[model samples]
Target chain A: MREITYREALREALFEEMRRDDRVFLMGEEVGHYDGAYKVSQGLLAEFGERRVIDTPIAEAGFAGIGIGAAMTGLRPIVEFMSWNFSFVAFDQIISNASKTYSMSGGKIKVPIVFRGPNGAAAQVAAQHSHTVEAFYAHIPGLWVANPSTPRDAKGLLKAAIRMDDPVVFLEGETLYNLKGEVPDASEDEIIPFGKARIAREGKDCTLIAWGAPFHTALAVADRLAKEAGIECDVIDPRTLRPIDETAILESVAKTNRCVIVHETWPYGGPGAEMVDLIQREAFDYLDAPVLRVGSLDVPMPYAKNLESLVLPTPERIETAIRRVTYREER
Target chain B: MSEVKVERWLDDYREMLLIRRFEEESARAYAQGKIGGFLHLYIGQESIAVAAATTIEKGDLVFQTYRDHGTALALGMTPEAAMAELFGKDTGCSRGLGGSMHYFDVENGFYGGWGIVGGHLALAAGAAFRSKYLGEDQVTLCFFGEGATNIGGFHEAMSLAGLWKLPAVFICENNQYAMGTPLSRTSPLSDLSVKAAGYGMVGDRFEGYDVDVVREHLKKAIDRARSGEGPSFLEIETYRFRGHSMSDPGKYRTAEELEERKKKDPILLILGKLRDAGVDEAKIEAIEDEVEERIEAALKHADEAPFPEESLLYETVTVEKF
Candidate 1:
């Protein structure tokens, strides 16, 4: 196994996929000559040439529609928004066209395209720049939504998203792009299918369910609880939100008799709310206490560092919620 | 007259008549509540679709707005499929998943009848881009109301098409009103073709009531695009005789104006041209009879067709239905 940054892992996936499939091309703002805003597509243009690594204008709706059209006409396009926040400009294209084309065309057409970009708070970037809209996208029927937390999952899930014969919204954590982790030295064809959860840490006292960058907070809280508070917990990371890994979460919850779902998205009408509903329905009888959730404060992320920190979920908050769910009193 | 000219003229006349009759029947069906949802009849603008479809090659693609029954009928979609789609039956072109506002048939190169006013322009540009990117000799034509020209997507899509040299033609049907708002009040420029210069593309305007005139203009534009000369914009002047949708009373214009436009009705205009060309009146009557029966059979088939199974509702919603 080799340790690489999540950004590097994503770049490798794009490079490998483009090499393997000529139909696959990366198109968006700064993807070609500029090598991407965050350089996730660095060296792609030079390696794949300008034709394959395209640079599009700053028209989100236009380019998003172009990606959908290209997908309809037998080319696989990876349309990159500068950030998930910018995707709102193209929401009509994503929701009305990309997500509905398959059914609208009587199953004769498939929009095999991926709309990917950095999502959530990248660091003090403020209100307009920070958004975790995976749940909003997953709410649509014809789309596949995935949010990968680690470098390995990023590469694997991205490869899978590109290969699937459907439209996919690939939400990458901006903060986790630079974070380093051990990735398996596997073949390029290897992929982690959607609707599967990875157990980040195994224990029995309680289960902490999370995804994307927030999974790190869950892992940290679980580690601290075990070492300092004598509480062991299982941390589950649901990589895909649409076809969610409910069985894994329910199994973990049933075994632990406790649950605390953590996410960086808004608490109201967010992914956590849907997860809570599902858990209560399927794993209701096994619960020892009411399932709790640790989510960001329901406000737009502020520009100031302190305010942004307060808006996002913290490990301490996750630990506190976990303790409450586990019925353990703090020292 | 050349044999080919007579044959082409007859084909265009038949197409225009079929669209006119199909729309008339659709109106009747909607009145009877056989068809549901918003129904936009392409009653007056039959020539534009007939001419465009006649000019475009088999491999050429078409993207249209919600008033798309005429366009789909002109593009060789079976009358049965179109009627079935309007009836929301399983045998429809979109298998009942898409009704009038969302008619689609990818295999026929008919992309969709998009509901949003101006949204499909970018999608059409992208389709053209794919054609160019893959070195395919395919041209894409996007048909939208003149009101759509005011939207940001129209500008973005047009600019991208020009900048990329995509093989596309954007046709704006300036049919007097966009759901009751006059074209004059909708955009600043009266001649919508002038907006094409902003995107650095060739611009042209046409009288949409005459099938021959529309076919000549559209043929020239399609040829230019097919030759890799980039996209073109055409603003066709026309009028919608009926209300915007099925429910519209169409009180925006006076009766005199409607009568004046009807004098140049596309189907009557072409039928007169056929008679002047010495095409037999008996042949014309026979064609009309055949078209009437086709429409009748299509309606009957759609009426008898079953609705989609309950499982199909969930099946077509996503690709991974299995």
Candidate 2:
């Protein structure tokens, strides 16, 4: 297995998919000569030419709808949003056209398009540019929401999303683009199926579940809990949100008898809330304590580094929640 | 002027008549509570749809706003399917899922109707992009009210169509009002074609009531698109005889204004042209009888059509297989 950066893995996935299928093309603002706003599409224009790797104006709604239309008429377009925060401008197109066309047209139309970009808070980037949209999109029935945390999952899930015969909202972690990890040198046919959970770390004392960037925080917290207090944990990353890997999550919860769901999104109606509800309903009788949730504060992200750090799901906060769930002594 | 063949002119006349009668029946159905949701009648604007449908070939796609029955009918969707869709029956074009606001007959190149004002314009441009990307000689006709021209999406879509030289004809049906908001109140300019100048595409305006004029101009625009020249913008000056939807009483306009606009009704204009071309009263009567019979058959079929099975409710939400 060769190690690669998450950004490079994404670029490879785009390159391989576009080469495999002529119907696959990329379009967004600055995707051509500019490579990409984040360089995820670097060198794509030179490889695929200007026709397939299109550079659009600063119009999300226009380009998104164009992608849907192209998909309807035999084209698999990969539309980049620069950031999920900017996806608001094109939300109507995603919800109305891309998501609903398959059902609205009575199965006559399928919008096989991918809307991908960086998501969640990045460093000091304030409220407007920082948003975790997995829950927002997962709420929609016709869309498949992919929140990939690692370089391996990012490449595999993106390739699957491009080939899937439905609209996919690929929410990549903004801070994880440069993170290095082992990405298999598999052929174009390799794809990590959706609705499968990956156990990042295995233990029996308690379950610490997270996805996207927060998965790293959960892992760090688990390591600290073990090293400092002799607490072992099961860290699970549910790769896809819509068709969630409920079996893996519930099995872990049932085994550990306690769970602490972690995420960087807001606390109210966030990914953690959905996981908590499922755990309480299915794994309630096996629980030693209530299923706890760890998420950002119930407010918009702040620009100040101190306030932003306070708002996000840090390792210390996750560790505190894990100890509380395991009934360990306070530090 | 080119001589309008009697048979082709009659076909257009009958097609327009079919739309008029179908909408009138739809209004009747709405009144009786047989149809639910927003029922937008294409009563007065029949000629634009007829001309647009007759001009474009089978491969060219058509996208329009909520007032889409006329376009669907003109594009050769069976009257039964359209009526059943309004009736929310399984036999409907959308299998009863899309109702009146959304109708799709993709096989015949009708991408569907959207209830959102200017949202479909971008989607239409996308379809046009597909044609250009694949090197297919197909054109797309997108219809929206003048009010939609004021929306931000309209600018985004039109700009991209111009920038990319997509094969799409952006037709603005300046039907005077958009859901009670007059074009004068919302639009910066009464002449919507001027907006096209900003996008660098050829802009034109015409009397929408005259089917011949609509056909002639639309043919040229469609030809231009198929020939890889680029998109064209047209503001078809028309009026909606009915209120915006079944709920509106249209009290904003005076009875006098309504009467004056009706005097130049598109159906009547086509009829007058046919009579002037020596189409005898017997021929007119025969066409009316045939249209009436078709409407009756559609109505009866729609009335008897079954409600979609409950099992189908969950289907079509996504592809059945990978």
Residue B213 lDDT in model 1?
96
Kindly list the per-residue Cα lDDT of model 2 for residues B1-322, writing each as its tens digit: 1355778778988999999999999999999999999999998999999999889987999998889999999999999999999999999999999999889998788988898888999999999999999989899999998888888889999999999999999999988988887878886787779888898799999889998899999999999899989999999999999999999999888999999999999888878888788878898889999999999999999999999998776788887342
Give DockQ: model 2: 0.71
Write down the C-alpha DockQ for each prediction. 0.73, 0.71
Q: Write the per-residue lDDT of candidate 1 for residues B103-126, one digit (tens) a residue.
A: 887767898889887889999998
**What is model 1's DockQ versus the real complex?**
0.73
Name the runs in model 2 displaced over 4 angstroms. B1-4, B320-322
Q: Is the docking of candidate 2 incorrect, acceptable, medium or high quality?
A: medium
